[model samples]
Target: MFKKVLIANRGEIALRVHRACKEMGISTVAIHSTADSNAMHVRMADESVCIGPPPAAQSYLSVPNIIAACEITGAEAIHPGYGFLSENANFVQIVQDHGIAFIGPTAEHIRLMGDKITAKDTMRKLGVPCVPGSDGAVPTLDEARKVAAEIGYPVIVKATAGGGGRGMKLARTEADIEAAFQTARAEAKAAFGNDEVYLEKYLDAPRHIEIQVFGDGRGKAVHLGERDCSLQRRHQKVLEEAPSPVIDAKTRARIGEICADAVARIDYAGAGTIEFLYEKGEFYFIEMNTRLQVEHPVTEAIYDVDLVQEQIRVAAGLPMSFTQRDLVPSGHAIECRINAESLPDFRPSPGRINTYYAPGGLGVRMDSAIYGGYAIPPYYDSLIGKLIVHARNRELALARLRRALSELVVDGVATTTPLFHALLDEPDIQAGRYDIHWLEGFLAREES
Candidate 1:
């Protein structure tokens, strides 16, 4: 096992990795920007390094500074928790070239799964189902039009390198095709520096379901069920739940095995998520995240495993502690991503936290880095914490979430806590009858 590992991110995820390393008897080196000088993870780590200024480009995303920190601290590995350089294939290769371990998949897999078009082609070859549309990039407006006609109306034009709803547009009818095609290409070029775009048969009211798979890079892998991330706003997941209320045992097992086998065939290492859009009892591959996801805790809660520790173990050349048969999922888990944002407008709410209190109990967990008097800098994402709750069933889990949310308090700054409260009262959310577009439509109704 590695004696020390450097965490190359910030906020709650950085703290999450630190706690995992500590439990595994591995020291940690926390890298922070000037803005995070007093961050919780930096304060708790055995060693610390200041990378650069508040801007992510000069700090969290700076490869040289991160590598230098590893060298200075004698850290043997780097655990990129979710964002920043976690999915950057070039950064992974650079770390490997420097002889430092990256606690994730191989650079080859990262690069392969990073591009949407390539990822879809790869999954299709592996026998995974995909949304039928373009065979490859539609390089011309005429080609886009041709593909749209072939796929029929209500097609979606997506950037080959897009995410977070950016560089994406939908054409519900033939009349909307030209606008969607041109706008998607422009947005793709602006956001990802790639004008390449692809087409997909748009599925109305599909659920966003993802399977969590872990591999040892030695032809061994296992699936830990699925998470229903249907509650989304603007294509960003807002809430997530494990043991999807809509998926039965047979459906879960079928999809889970397919994902596990697919990754094992590629000899993928560490943690990865294969996302899909499910509708009418069929699953269509959307994309693959080459690193740990933001909603990993829900999976962990249901399976009773520490994913970060497992990432470290596999990276250290150790065999996985369990096999597929050993993964016995229990109960239900839900995670609410608490962000520093105001209601209605959802604007950024960054400032000093005057009074902070986390809910506690047998089945509730609050993963956060902020404390009283800590200033939330506006230079990063608005997410400040994740409130997770687990129970014997989905109904109890929802009840527990409500109870926990009431006890939680964060003063001197607004949060999205109220949003979750309102969601809990809705019958669709309570009965798990929501689709990917449910939240957006609900919010729109509220606005009207």
Candidate 2:
């Protein structure tokens, strides 16, 4: 067990890792920016360090500042909660070189899975189904056209280093290919500093399902099940649920094995997610997130496991306390991202929280770092919290989530709460009949 661990991020996830470390009888050091001086995570941590100014590039994402904080606090390990440096292979290598353990997968696996094209190829070779596309990055327009022709007309150009759909473009016909290709390349270069892009057959309507797998860094792994993250807007997940309504028991078992085996094959460590696009009983690999996810709570609620704790144990070189046979989904769980944003327009709202009251009851969980008198900085992502609920079944889970949402309150700032309230009334959402595009279309209809 580690004597102390430093959290190299801010907000709910940093607090999340802090809590997990405390439970393991380990102390925590929190690193925050100047804007987050009064944030809840910093207030609760055993020690807090101000890394830099408000902007993420100068603070949260600054590797030198984070490493300095760890050195000052004598932290033996670092837990990068989700974003920032969570998936940065270079950061992982640097931390290892400094003799500090990074609580995630190896740098090799991170680099391998970080590139979309390379991840698809690796998965394909491991017998995991991947979307039909170029074997590697499409280097020329001719190669893009050839791959698009073979994959059929409606193809998508995606950045090799893309996530959050920033570097993705769709072409419905030959006339749209060149424009889409150029746009994807430019966006990819601007966003990820990589101009490489790839082509793939685009599925018009598909559910975004991801399997949660944990590895012990020694080729042993187990899966907790899957999350239906189809309710997304602008390629960013807004709502997520565990024990996908569409995946049957047999399909769940099959895909779970595939993901677990893939992790084992790569000798991956810690918690990771393998995302897929499912349509008509078939799943095509999309990409793998090689770190703890924001929606990991839903999986933990249903599987009765603490993924953060597991990641810590794995980093400490401890064998898993539970095995595959011990894993089982006991109930349905759903999570609503509670972002500090306005409704309909969905613009970011960052300001003082005059009043704050989070819902609480059996089977309800609220993960947040905001409180009354706290001012949310405008520079970071708008996400302020996550509201999750669990029940014996999907119907009961939805009912509980709705009730919890109604009880929640945040004053003096606009929030996306109204969006969830509106979504609850939709028949397709209630029936679990929506795909990845369904939420975007729903929002469009509402705005119109």
Candidate 3:
């Protein structure tokens, strides 16, 4: 076990890692920007350091600042809790070069999975199903156009290095492809510093299902099951649940085994997720997130696993105590991402919070860093908190989420709670029949 560790991100996740480390008897070093000088995570960790100013580029994303903080605090390892430097392969290498353990996968694994293009190829070779797409990155506009034609109409041009819906364009016709190709290339270059792009057959009513797997360096790995993240807005997931209501016993077993095998093949270490697009009962591998996912709590609730602690243990070279046979989901768990937004074409809402309250009771969990008098600086991600609920079944879980959302109170700034309430009342969501496009259409119907 590491004597001390550093958390290189902020908000609820930072606090989350703190609690986990405390239980493991490991001290923590919390790094915060100037804006988060007095945040809860900083106060909770045994030691805290101010990295930089409010801007993320100079603070949390600053590689030298993070490494310097680790060196100064004498931290043996660094735990990047999602976003910021979590998925950065170069960042991982930098930490390793300093003889500090990066509580994530090896740099090689990160590189292979971080690039959307290379990941798709690996999935294809590993016998995991993937959508039909270009064999590799298209270097020229002409090459992109040719690949788009090969994949047929209604294909998506995506950055080989992008995630979270950035650097992506949808083209359904020759004219659309002609107009969007260069813009996508330039946007990809700017956002990800890579002009490389690829084409994929876009599935129309796809449900995003992802399997969570953890690998240790000792040639052992296991799957904790899957999560249904199909309910998305603007290609970003808004709601997620565990043991997707759609997957059957046989399919789940097959997917779990295949995902574990894929990770083993790469000799991947640390926790990762293999996301797939499921439409009409067929699963097509989409991409892999090389770090802990944002919606990870839902899986933890159902599986009764402490993923944060597991991440630290993996970093310490401890083999998993359980295997595939020990895998079993107890009940239904659902998560609603409470983004700072206004309803109907929601946009980012960042400001000082005046009143803040979270629900309490069994079966409900709230993960947040904002509180009364907490200022939500506009220099970073829009997520404010995650409202999670667990129950004996999906129906009860939905009802519990409704009550929890209603109980949650935040003043002085708008939130997406209203939209979440409206969504919970939808027939498709009620039936667990919703897809990514369901939220938009439901909102349109509500407005009508």
Candidate 4:
């Protein structure tokens, strides 16, 4: 086990890692930017260092600064919670070269799954079902037309290196193919600096379901369960739930085993998630996240496991403490991302918080770094916290989340709390009958 660990990120996730380390009898060093000099995580850490200015590239994303901080504090490992350098292959390689452990998967796996086209090919080869389309990059409009004809229309073009809904386009007819293809290529080049694009048959109303898998790096792996992240806005997940209301025991067991088998086959280590789009009892591979996800709390709440601690143990060359038989979800869990953004418009709301109070009650867990007086900087993501609740069943879980959201208060800045409140009242959301596009359509209806 590592004696001391350095956290190379900020906000709620950084605090989450710190708490995990403390519980494991490990000391933590918090690296922050000048903007976060008075952040909550820094105050709670055993050691704190200011790496650079408020800009993320110069601070949280600066590899040299992170390395310098780890060296100065003598941290044996670096825990990059979620974003920044967490899944960066180069960062992992550099940290490993310096004899410092990275609490994540191997760099080779990261590189392999980082590109969308390569990831799809690999998953297909592993017997993981994928949307039928071009085997590789389209390369030409003529080739894309042929693929469209073979796979049927309504195909989507996606950037190999893109995410967050960027560098993607849909062509529903033959006439739209050329324009869509060219636009996707241009957007891909502008966003990822790589014009490489691929096509896949676009499912109209697929649910975004992802399976969580953990590997010991030695050929052993297990799947915890699935997370229903279909509640999304502009392709970004807004809310997540565990033990998806749609999946049955048989489907769950089959998909979980497939994901675990794939992870073990690749010798993957630590925490990873294999995302899929499910529709009409069919699952199609979407992508893979090689690091901890923002919605991990819901899974933990239902599974009763500390994923961060498990990740650390895996990094230390320890086998997973539990077998597949021991991993069974007991209840329902829901997570609401509390972002510093206004409702309807969804504009960023970053300012000094005059009043802040998080909800607390049975089965309620709030993970946040912002306080009453903290000034939220506009340099990063708008997410300020996550509100998670667990119960014996999905109905009770939804009721708990509603109560918790009502009790929560954050004044002096707009937030997405109102949006969640509205969602809780929707018939589709109440019945768990939503897809990846449902939330967007609902929001659009509200605007109209």
lDDT of 2 by residue, 1-448 (tens): 8999999989999999999999999999999898889899999999999999998999999999999999999999999999899999999999999999999999999999999988998999998999888888999999899999998979999999999998899999999999999999999999999999999999999999999999998999999999999999999999999989999989999999999998998888999999999999999999999999999999999989999999999999999988999997898999999999987788899999999999999999999999998998999999999999999999999999999999999998999999899999999988999999999899888879
Q: Model 1 TM-score?
A: 0.99
Q: Which structure among the candidates has the greatest lDDT?
A: 1
Better of 1 and 2 by lDDT: 1
Clashing pairs in 3: none
Candidate 1 vs 3: which has more TM-score: 1
lDDT of 4 by residue, 37-148 (tens): 9999999999999999999999999999999999999999999998788879999999999999999998999999999989999998888888888889988999999999
Model 1 clashes, total count: 0
Q: Assess every candidate by TM-score.
A: 0.99, 0.99, 0.97, 0.99
Q: Model 3 compared with the native: what TM-score?
A: 0.97
| lDDT for predicted candidate 4 compared with the true structure | 0.94
Off by over 4 Å in 2: none
Q: What is the lDDT of residue 256 in candidate 4?
A: 92
Worst 10 residues of 3 by lDDT: 318-327
Cα lDDT for residue 227, candidate 1: 99
What is the alpha-carbon lDDT for the whole of candidate 1? 0.96
